[model samples]
Structure formats: structure tokens, C-alpha cells
Target: MTEISKISLRNLQKRFGEKVVLNGVDLDIAPGDSMVVIGSSGTGKSVMLKCILGLLRPDGGTIQLDGNDIGTLRQRERNALLRHVGMLFQGGALFDSLPVWENVSFGLLGAGGISRRDAKDHAIETLAKVELDAPTADLYPAELSGGMQKRVGLARAIAASPDIIFFDEPTTGLDPITADVINNLILERVQELGATTLTITHDMASVGKIASRVAMLHDGKIIWSGNASDIDRSDNPYLNQFIHGEAIGPMRPDVSTTMPKETY
Candidate 1:
């Protein structure tokens, strides 16, 4: 049987002032599929994720989750839908004020009203799932290294056992070994839960390791998408340039004009 799509975007469009971020972008992710969206900076990759999360309202098009149009949902309804989704932000975005376990169980404490003792137990279990030891649970975010913090963030994201997970720049700013470990952890967790995931990253290594399907975003649209094995043989000039990290291609010259000077 064909798997149903957990998330679908049809002709999705978003704009910040006069700048069009996503223009007629369409994609479908089957339940339990791992899709990695690769793109250069300023291609609206983050915006696309935000639109799906209802953090940013799109100017046009539709975003559907389980066949329901969530783009037009009221705040309460949107929050209800978001309850089933988990997110690992780009920066590990942990609250410095909270201890590690508190950070990891924040969602459970707030949304599920899980008792503190039960929440701590769940947090410890989730942390172990990410290969983190129990000792790190009491340490503050400031005391942990970057990789440890990321693991904590991952633990927190999965604490709710969300049906869908969104990973933004999961491997960014990590040493090679650490990045690989995180990638493997992501794969293990997704497989363990059979949850659909959408990841946004430019790291080709992470792409090869974690993605079942790859999509290339450019000029506010998904210009190309295919299975992971086909990526090396895609023959699409844009895909070639991106995966190879080349300075010259159909995608290069256009980059200079895409982002504002201050962003550089």
C-alpha cells in the first residue's frame, strides 16, 4: 500500500515585504519518510519550514497535514496541530536559565502537564536515546559543549514522541565525527519512532547519511528532488554545483543578488 503523506505543500508562497521567498513551491512527504531540503543561504529554506509550522503566515498557497489545511487554522487549532510536531532549531536554542533535564522535558511539562518526577524520568530516557549519559541532565546549557547541547535539543524534541519532526541545520558547526554521530542518532530515532521528518541543511555528508530523498531549493522553489542514491548522478547542473560546493554553476551568479548586503 502507498503511504499517506504526513505533510504536503501546494503552490506555497511567502513574502517578506516585496521579496518573494517561496513561489509556487510544491512537495509531498509520505509518512515516515526522511526528506532533506538542501539549498544555499537565503533561498527561503527556513521560511518554508516556518510556513509549515505556522510560525510565518504565507501570502498564498496551502499547507496540509493529514489532509487538513492548516495554513488557515486559528491559533488554538494551529497549536493543536503543532502538538504532534517536534522541532530541533538551528542553534540548539536551549534556555540558559533551565537545567538540562528541565530543558529536555519543557514540552512535556507544559503541554502534557507531566509531573516533574515523571518528566525527569522521560527526559533521562530521551537523553539516553541520543546517546547522552544521565549525568549531563543536571548540568546547565552553559556547561555543556556544542555537541552535547545539540543532543539535549534532540532529546527535548523527541520527548513528546511527536508524529513529525523538523530538524533545521542539524549538522551545522560540528566537527566531522560529532556531526556523523548526530546524523546517525537522527536516523536511529526516526527509525525507532517511524516518524516522518523534514530536515533543512546544506551539509552534503548529513544529506547522504540521513536522507531517504533529497530536494534542492532555489529561487524560492524546489528546483529538483529525487532519491538519495540518485543525487550523485542527478546530472542537474544546479544539483551538481551544490553537492560539489563549486563556485561556478547556474546557481552561483544568482547568489550574489539573492541576499542583501548586510546579510553577507
Candidate 2:
């Protein structure tokens, strides 16, 4: 039997009609590994993340979580598997209607992980871990600044103490300093949890700070992967063009792939 990874995607394929978003993608994330996938605006980074999270069904391939093939897991089994996962969406996708405490504890409250009476307290505690104070917990998502919203989202993601955390563009829409701040918080929290992480971002600064291993995705495949420190020294023309942000290179701008994602 092939040894299992903490999370593995083998021959993963996804397409929107004829648009091949992910083509035979192969990647493995081991336990407690901080793996970052870097790519330009599109190239199916989000699509790949969605596939692992079971939000989208792949046209072909398998995603295994802790040695178990996710495609084969029953609905209840899948739900149980998902309980160990946490996600911080790119946009701090919080419910505007829910206050910070409720937002932070949303999963715990909804998933029967915490009692109603204790949920608020747990949320407050989690918020503190991200350097969000108790009072901020009373505000709605709309009331907070972009950075605060990100912190609250981080608080929510870590509230359940998930074994695996996914960070989607963790520093998006922030000033450079704020982005750095969020990156630091993410690094601290990931280390504190000793949890495995899969981060998808184009931000090089975030990559420098958060990645234990960095993978470059282009044309729906990982073109290169190595220690984060080695990215600048890579000889691959595609990788060199990408990391240096050069216009004239082998990589033609993938106009076919849009900013958010491929259209349905």
C-alpha cells in the first residue's frame, strides 16, 4: 500500500467544460507541514483548495485525508473528517449579521462542539489568541477594519483547534505593514497549534514568512516546489519570471483564467 500523507491529491483533475483548471495535479501535504502554493491570479489555486475541502467535486482523482480517500468517505464520515479542518477565506467571509463572538464560534456553535452558554466565552478566548480583545467580539464584521476582520476570521478558524488549516490569500486587501502583521499572527498561531497548513497566496512576502515549502502552480500544475528560500535561485524560466514579476517570459498571461475563478 502507498504510504498515506496527511492530505494527498493524486492525478487530480478539474475542468469547467473544456477549460482545464487543474490537470492531473499531484501534491501531498504531510502532518504539520506548512505548505504554500503560489501562483498568479488564477491557474486553479482556489479550485484546487475547493476540491480538497469537498466544496467541489473533481472530474477525476482522489483527495485523501489522513490515509483515507475523501472521495470514498460516506457523508457522515466526510462530515467527521471535515470537523478537523479550518479555513480562512481570502475575503474574511464572515456573516455581517453575526457579531464577532458569534462569528468566531460559528463552527463550534453550529457543529455541536460547544454549548450555547459557553460559545461566547470560547469565542472571546479564541479572539484573544489572535490579539483581538474581548470588546471587539461585540462588533459586527462590518464594523471592523480590514485587519480586524482578518483577525476575527483567524480567530474563527482556530476556534475549533483543527488539525489542518487552510489560509486563502491570508494577507489580501491589507497595507504592507498590516499584511506583515497578519502573516506574523498566522505564523504564530500555526506554530502554537502544531497543525498542518495549506496556504494559497500570490503574495511573496507572505510566502517568505509562512512557507516551510513553496510550490509554484502554472498551467494547472505545480511547476516547482522546494524550500521557500530556494525560490529566488530556481533556474526554471517560468519560476524566474513569476518570482521576479517580469512581463517578458515564457509564461503568457493566462487570459483564459479569470481573477476570482473560471466561470461555470
The predictions' CA RMSDs to the true structure, in order, are 2.7, 1.9
Candidate 1, residues 74-193, lDDT tens digits: the string is 888878777788899999999999999999999778887679999888889899999888988999999999999899999988888898999999989999999999999999998988
Question: What TM-score, over all chains together, does every model reach?
Answer: 0.94, 0.95
**Could you tell me the C-alpha RMSD of candidate 1 in Å?**
2.7
Query: Per-residue lDDT tens digits of candidate 2, residues 102-158?
Result: 998888887885687699999989999999889998899999999999999898889
> What lDDT does model 2 reach?
0.89
Which 10 consecutive positions of candidate 1 have the poorest summed lDDT?
A: 255-264
Question: Which residue runs of candidate 1 sit more than 4 Å off their true CA positions?
Answer: 1-3, 253-264
After superposing candidate 2, which stretches have Cα over 4 Å from the reference? 1-4, 256-264
